[model samples]
Target: MSEAFGSVLWLIVAIGILVTFHEFGHFWVARRCGVKVLRFSVGFGKPLWSRKDRHGTEFAIAAIPLGGYVKMLDEAEYEVPAAQLGQAFNRKPIWQRIAIVAAGPIANLILCVALLWVMFLIGKPDYSATLGPTQGLAAQAGLRDGDRLERIDGRSTETAMDALQVLMLAAIDHRDVAIQASDANGHEVQRKLALSRLPADFDQQNLEKAIGLVWHFQVAPATVGTVTPDSASAGLLQSGDQITAIDGQAVRYWNDIAPLVKQWGERGGEAMVEVDRQGERLALLMQPRQQLNPDTKQQAWVLGITPAPRKAPEHDALRRYGPLEAIPAAFRQTGRMASDSLAMMRRMLTGEASAKSISGAITIAQVANATAQQGPATFIFFLALLSLSLAILNLLPIPVLDGGHLLYYLIELVKGSPLSERSMVAGQYIGLALLAGLMGLAFYNDILRLVT
Candidate 1:
């Protein structure tokens, strides 16, 4: 299947699963608390399929797979019958009503924890801090190939990639990054180095010259892993031929050669490729097919050759844990993620983080698809994180959410009575407007990302 179609399919699955679980939480909790749940729905809009249970709750699968909801028997809108008043959400004690409203988000949180625990048991790919030298300007700056960076500006490096990112960000600002390192000599050293930045007309050659660091991991040479029967790559290159160079440039590594091949498509001419087959260097002249990088808005070449898989380092491979250990670790990881997300949200609100980083449905869909591709364990972990986010967001005491309901309950507790119906309705409308505005902004950002 096409990647785009696959992405859409995965997105549907993700939303469907998450929404179902979320609504189910409310249904289960309300039923347990003696509150009558009128409906438990997966998705919104018109119901595609629905069935009424003995308890009078309609369980449904709706037409829209974007979101779902749970409806409770409450007098918030209509008057409750005296016979069923005991089971009305609004007639319940403040605490019980609060529990019924809060259960949905709490269910999401619980799902996240369970998924995370399972993910930890299944394992995940990891990497250590390692750096390789890039050709051109960076190599000239006393940075040697195969040099593992230890630190930058006196900050200890957790990974070599982190150190390089600092340098790249500094380069973007035309500033020098102070690097502290342990070279081949095993002696610690430090240097303030300036990075080369690409001009406005940044191409492959200049891009390579500007930032000069490479990944330490080894990737197989550009060889056909899978070929579309009549694709450009299949027509010109064979599966077993090891790609040696693109154009006339010597391809030192897989990363070095791939972009060059992609550039061939933009040039719209014959690309001179050097391939090694059992020690024989064969030159193949091939034309690149034009393609667009949807996310980047850049034109590029297409060969349709999947590169060979790279081996993950032992330390980077997934590690399984005992059931006893997994529980605590899962809780710790979940807490940390929750805390970090809250911090980031606060930072975004305060303008400490760039608003451009605020992502919407597009970003969420992309992440969900990517995580699902990694396997069930990884997908589950992502779902968990998203669940936690949902739980936290709903608990913000904003009207139109569970937290808003809780806030009303709290006011009832303090004032010895519920807020006036008109006041409650006004708050709900205000909250809905605020949420709509936020959604609009997020969607706008998503479109900007797609177009740009």
Candidate 2:
């Protein structure tokens, strides 16, 4: 219950920020275009809180918090007195109207970039672009464990996330992706990853497993950090015990000890663990516990101990940029995100991708909560990602959306007249229906995911 409540609260805070910026875009541009803004609302339905500005505009916080709008004086929606006719939205030039309508999504895009800029300055925790044990086709392609990924198809990859993004796109396109990697001895090697064998309907959820891209490189010691109370290792293992061997087998890292523990649990055997406690070597006999994996719903071995801290290499540390240097980096990152989002949408629409890729409020709330727990940097990145998504979603050429409004304005510009009222209303109905269906599908996916 507490977790659910925290998710809900974080979701509200995140949505409030995005909605405020979206509406502010319209409000700012409308005022600049000399349009009389009547109301600036963060959400729909009756206003929960409202205050009339000096210019007679009502600033409000409404009951609903999912979305918001900026209401302007338009002759089509309401009567404008003769004295205020010049400030009416309907009376503005087509270009000004287009600008006013475009500003909301544009603001979202700008916010995404701005957030990324700040994020770059603050830096992000990242694992090295190194590979663990490779299996399947990747291994056959000569990609080996401990090979540090340098570049994918000419794009420099500093982290696993960067490599995954490029690899996912390559898989979706069914193309051979060129990769440059450095072996453990710092020897550079080249390889090509074939993606033609992937199913046409591959989605984000299982992409990593499908592509065999695992980031479990051995970079940390196998030292016990904590022991869960009342568990199998409760009294047998203590924190700060560096495991040197298990069952007479040398344990070089946590990876080495993990499989041994699992092997012991599978046969219900005891493990003879040799640990270095301070300057003394201690021998302990411990039995592994059988626990269910929450994610995969499979039974697995558990040691009830957390790994000690491991410091990454300086070169593999988080990337930080100065203010001036971060500008172009943020621009490139945002542009790439926009392109990837558009490509994914295109694939989904073309039946090449699964609709399960679409996430609703529940999934988003859970993600928000998870990222919030990670730290401020991760939460900021999450906001940027969601903001960019909002920008792209609103820019789609559908009615009732900013993109839809722009589409109508474009038609008006091209045809030299506004669309007929009946046609406009019909388009609006179609757009609303499409949006409703999309939302319903997203909600269904979210519920389905929650259950299974």
Candidate 3:
């Protein structure tokens, strides 16, 4: 299947499942609250398939895959018959109404937590910082080499990998990251370091292209693992030879060699590579090959040498947690993920992150396809995360969204009456406009990424 088609299929499935579950939450809650639900849909527009349930609620699958909604028998729109008055949505107690409105987001959060727990139980491979050289590049502002990072920008980190994630998120748009480091002696120091500014072509919505900085601890040794046939590195570098330097500059590790090679390509020049074969030093002149990464649409250089995997400390094979422990761990992990996502959103809003990050249906489809290819576990995890995001977004106080409706209901509760019809109509129009504008921007970004 074509990548685009695969992406769309997965996206449709992912969105369909999440939306159906979300609408189900509202439907279930409303029934419990004695409200008459008119329709429970899995998507928008004209219904392709539908059935009236035993309770007289029309359950449907619509033509559009965008989203779904629940229609309730609201008294504001029509007079409620005496017998059916008790089943009208507006007739329900405020608390009951609130519960119905809140169910959808809660359902999403529940999915996130459950998926995370399963992921933890299955266990994901984690790289340790201990595999790196005991000494390397410092933060340059105040952090010293050999100092282990404890936190980044005030976010507590359990592993070195988490710290790197925090740093990358803060680095978007050249933001300064506050890092806390500790030495063997247990002394801790905090310092703020500014990230290198993004290139002009960088897009914030496309995360893979926005932050390209390599983590300090992730550098591999400058030893070739495999050499492709008829490639640049095949005839020049041997598998066992240690790369000592590039272009006369000393290369202590795999990380050191990569930047030099990339720079050579960017500068459109040749580089001299020095290697240590046994005890004799050998030099080779190389010209980096520049090519566009079709996936990212960005220029990258290749020398055709794949680095050996970093040796990890032998740990007991993946450990599974008990049910009780898994629950809390899942909640904590999901909360952290949500917070990190929110931080990225804030950066995008402030223009600290590139606008390219505002992806449309195309990008989402691509992500879905890629995730699907990673196997069931990975795809389930992706669905959980996306469901959580969708739930959270729907709760936002913007009109035309679930959150917006909740916001209006809250106002009604506070004022002891619904907003004037004219006011509600105006808010609806405004919400529609905002939604349209955002979709336009996302589509435009998608097009730019496709063309450029």
Q: Considering lDDT, where higher is better, how would the candidates rank from best to worst?
A: 2, 3, 1
Please provide, for model 1 over 25-67, each residue's C-alpha lDDT reduced to its tens digit, 9 standing for 90 to 100: 8888889889988888888899999999999999899988898
Put down candidate 3 lDDT per residue, 406-439, tens digits, no spaces: 9888999999998998998999999999889988
Which candidate tops lDDT?
Answer: 2
Candidate numbers sorted by TM-score from highest down: 2, 3, 1
Off by over 4 Å in 3: 46-48, 76-81, 126-150, 153-161, 168-212, 216-320, 346-353
Q: Clashes in model 3: which pairs?
A: 204-354, 204-356, 204-357, 205-356, 205-357, 205-358, 206-357
Minimum summed lDDT over a 10-residue window in model 1 is located at 199-208
Q: Give me the candidate number with maximum TM-score.
A: 2
lDDT agreement with native, every candidate:
0.72, 0.87, 0.75
TM-scores, all candidates, are: 0.68, 0.83, 0.72
Q: What is the C-alpha RMSD of each candidate to the true structure, in Å?
A: 8.5, 5.0, 7.1
Q: Give me the displacement of residue 124 in model 3, in angstroms.
A: 2.8
Model 2 TM-score is 0.83
Model 1 Cα displacement at 369 (Å)? 2.4
Q: Which stretches of candidate 2 lie over 4 Å from their true place?
A: 199-204, 217-316
